[model samples]
Target: MRTIVAQDVVSASKFNRFHLLVFLWCFYAIGFDGFDIAMYGVGLPWMMEEWNLSALQAGAVGSYSLFGMMVGALVLAPVADKFGRKNVIIICMFLFSAFTLAAGLSPNITMFTIMRFIAAIGMGGLMPNCISLMTEYSPKKQRALLVGAIYIGYALGGILASLIGMYLVPQTDWRVLYYIGAIPLLTIPFFIKQFPESLSYYLARQQVGKVVEILNKVKPDGNFSEKDDYQLHTALKDGKGFPVKKLFTNKRAFTTIAFWIAIFCTMMMAYGLNTWLPKIMQSSGFSLTSSLSFNIMLCVGQIAGTLIGGYLAGKIGYRKVLVSLYLMGVVTFIALSITTNVALVYFLIFLGGASTVGAMNLGNPYITEFYPREIRATGMGYAQAIGRIGSILAPTLIAMLLVTGIDPKMAFATFAVPSILAVLGYLLVQEKYGSFDKVVEENGMNEEFIEGENKRIIQS
Candidate 1:
């Protein structure tokens, strides 16, 4: 009996129903993640009015959820590495949904803020694990596109939140939005039934039975047997030294630090804009309806940007693409500061969304490519957690500046500075570590295995 490496089986398989199923579920999970996060921003204007919140108070409320997400990303995400991706994701889905529902029922701002924080723990855990599972299941050639496609759900979620707010919030209470967030819980039963554990996780555990079972589904034609052994083509084996510690060893220290910096700056800008864009537009003389419309436009641009950015990164290189996006983002922010025309403001906001939110999401595939499977979740989780520092600060900082009587354009320009720093971070990474593809190739299995499998399938 011949031994088949798990990854080879996945890479060699044709795009089929199984891959589509995985994509759909991952997309569903991530879409809700975005919806839950964006709901606060969509409802913020109403909450401020109803509660009589000062800018600082509202900003602090926004930070509560982000801080919870930081805890979840840093603390809860690593558990997926030890337990299983499917289990952790299911738990997280339940955690966020239940608490978000509770948030709607809170009587006071303190209670509401507490619920949001608790719910965010689950929100934070879902993203990295979802990204990791998607990466594990995807073919190397299509990895970037798959990651990007799944995250389009995130943009869709944001759009949905904006739409709900626009239509429902005016006619009803803001709590209705939180009630809608609870809808994701209905999908939990289906997820329990359909979602598969990562094959790499199983293979890492040396669980031959589970590996063969999933591989059979992944490549239905393959007659995988119990006697057939499995391998991973990776240098580090499962249960190696502290997963987090490994990140700093083998010359990964600098790349790891650089990537963290990139995530931090990009996330600061992304979250800042996400939390405050509507308010900023409103302050700039746009009506509430027009401001929310800008939020929708921002998400529309993000959807387009993710697809386009992923395609461009595949062709030119991830580093070049990110650096260019960040530079373009800086220019767009400056344009936004000076523009008074409503139409121009909409255009600039769309571009800003593309450069900020879209660019930030593009980092997921790059991070997955950089780390080994053994610690991929940990590496990603830590990066996300550190980035949350910026997320945590974004809303509060913008609020403070605005409340202090600073020009809204200057406030936005302050946010733009992070994009320049992000560009520098990417350049430093390229200088130190080389291209994203090169790093992935160094860590990945031999190309011949992929080619040979394709040839064998064709011959069969």
Candidate 2:
């Protein structure tokens, strides 16, 4: 009987067309999420003016969507582990695309905020699952670089939103952007037909046939077939039990909490800029055009930072890179707050984007690598869901500071505080807690694997 090791096959496989196809799936979906996020920021100044909204009211409107994103991250993303990643991704895309279009047609601020909240649920759910999917498929050697590459799609989406907003929001209306968001709905059916399911998800369910099918595609030369006998001693054991509780097992609790804190700060920085930077730039005495230009620069810097972070992470380590990024955020935000020169301001904003959203893009792959395959999606979800609290708060807090007649410089400086905390959070994480670490805390060395009664984390 032919035997297949699901974990071995995937990790040892070479990158090919199949891998690139998977990248496209994740990249395009995440790009749409980024585009929707930028829409709100681009539309915010106009939305407030159109509705005669106070600063507090506009902040509340922004929080509504973040609230939805938090709910979806906490609730929907984990469902992918059960129902399958591909299914959940398709559901999220449908809802996100449909509701975004609905938001544009909204007759009042009340209706618009409600629609945005619903659409954002999809965006929130989609982000973590895509990260999980991409991480699972990536060869361990190139994982960080591939994850970083997909995020370029996210940055490009932001650039697309900014460019469209620069022209359309001023010429016709912000609604035009939302109309374009619905375009994803048309492509969902095609993805459903072509997208592949998670190999481990099938293995966990004891569906060897599906596992064989996926392995065949991932490495077509392997000649995998349903007829092959499989020995998934790891999957059968690890797959049992609730994925969430298992996160605390093997003395992983502290590292889990540290990741949560770090991600929370990352989101706080990322969403703060995505939602409020343009307005912050305007309030700092820049023109409307230049303010929007600053946001574009922020996205451009993200692409640069993500690629650099990925490369540096491979050479040094992500933990060090992450801390450095946070420190960069601290310095750039402080400098940006005080700088008056156009060239200097742009440079600071670029670094701020790198340290903020760019750092966030890299953080996901880092977290996923630490987690075992069975709980990868759940692990990423909890971090982002908890982190969403910071994301949810940033818009309102920035708005409150703006309304309080505080110095715009001081308001910008507040972001520096979280970056400082994030530095500490990343530092506290124990490297031994990582899934791939051979010397784990559980045994002070890798625990011996004994299937059935004695199995632990399945080696991914």
Candidate 3:
């Protein structure tokens, strides 16, 4: 079989029509994940009103979803390697679509909570695999940009959910929003027909015939030669077994753990504010209408931040950009907590949303770049799973303080501490490690390092 060389990825302009089509599917899957996740925030106010829930009860809903996501990311990420990325993604989409629709059909709080939990699993699994698939298929130089760009779907979804919720809140029931969520299911069949499994996975698994088929599909005019056979084996063998264990086995152990911790801290700040910001503002004397409108600004900032982060990371480097953004976020979170001036609060809120969302968008691709294709999904998954833990705790902890009549600024301040942890984590990882390229070369995955230096990360 002819080998798809690393150089082929470097010259992205040569990507044939088939690659572009597959690329579209990858974007679509992530887009669906983005929409489903953001839907929770949009429905929060209406659901609380309809059920007469306490602030703690409302927070529980967010917790349940994060809990579900944690479980999903842990379970599905590794299993996707064993089974296949495409199949797992298809199943994950179905799980969330069906359960989210069930959320609409719930008669009481118990059912809605249960359904959201189920949907969270699907939501959690969908993200890492979507990221992995995109990375695995992309040209080396474009990996970070494409990965970050695809996440725009996430911010877009957040905006879409807010818009839909705002528009429908006046006329239709909140339950109907869940019904609209199920629309993602319609794309499942189309994905199944068009999606390609990761070439790296197939090569590693020694499915030579399938690898050749996929490569031919990826590069229709290119010829496969026997010399490519050795490279395929090298790529496939690069990252097999307990990926998390492997990450820790080398000098990378501490750095890897630090990155995960950074992700956790970053997500805690993001989700804490996302799930509770409106509630906190309302309690601080803002009207529900104004609080709801704030989401539009937040999402707009998120989109801008995501685009800017992607571009900046491509130019400056991911970790530096992420660290700087997190610091900015911490400052904004502080400003948001203390300010009562409506206009200024809105501006700070938007800036805060931009930093947090952009940081996440930039960070995921950075994590994905740390591993070879064989274990890339798993690494991203563990980071996301651990990150979900932060998300799970943020709303719960903030709610507990608020219920006890603690100061609202103090409650927000509690959530802001994680950003400091994240900054420390990034700095520690960067200071401790060499470029990831040396590690990958030392680990002997040299042949499979298809992407160039621009996309390569240090071991951390």
lDDT tens string, model 2, 1-460?
5656665455556798888899998999999888998888988888888889888898888888998999988887678877788888998999899999999999999899889999988988998899988888876667788988899989988999888878878999879889988989999989998788887788877888788778887778778777776666677787778888877998789999999999999898888889888888888888887888988999999999999999888778888999999998999888877878889888888998899888988888888878888888899988999999999999899988888887776777888999999999999988776775221223322223322133333222
State the lDDT of candidate 1 residue by residue for 1-460, as single tens digits.
Answer: 5656666567656677778889999999899888988889989999998899998999999998999999999887678887788999998999899999999999999999999998999998999898888877876667778888898999999999999889988999999989988887888998999889977677766777988888788878778867875654442365456778877876788888888898999889888888998898888877888888999999988887888998887788677888888999989988888777878888888888888878877887787667767677888888899899989999999998898887776677886799998988777763333213221222233333422112221111
How does model 1 fare in lDDT?
0.82
Task: Estimate the overall C-alpha local distance difference test score of candidate 3.
Answer: 0.74
User: In model 2, how large is the Cα lDDT of residue 384?
Assistant: 91
Candidate 2 positional error at 138, Å:
0.7
Q: Summarize candidate 3's per-residue lDDT along 361-440 as a digit string, tens digits.
A: 88887887776556778888998999999899988888888889877766656646787888888887743333233212
- Stretches of candidate 1 above 4 Å error? 232-236, 430-460
Q: Is candidate 1 or candidate 2 better by lDDT?
A: 2
Ten residues in sequence with the least summed lDDT for candidate 3 = 438-447
Residue clash pairs of candidate 1: none
Q: What is the C-alpha RMSD of each candidate to the true structure, in Å?
A: 3.7, 4.3, 4.7
The CA lDDT at 281 in model 2 is 80
Can you give the lDDT of residue 457 in candidate 3? 22
How many clashing residue pairs are found in candidate 3? 7
Better of 1 and 3 by TM-score: 1
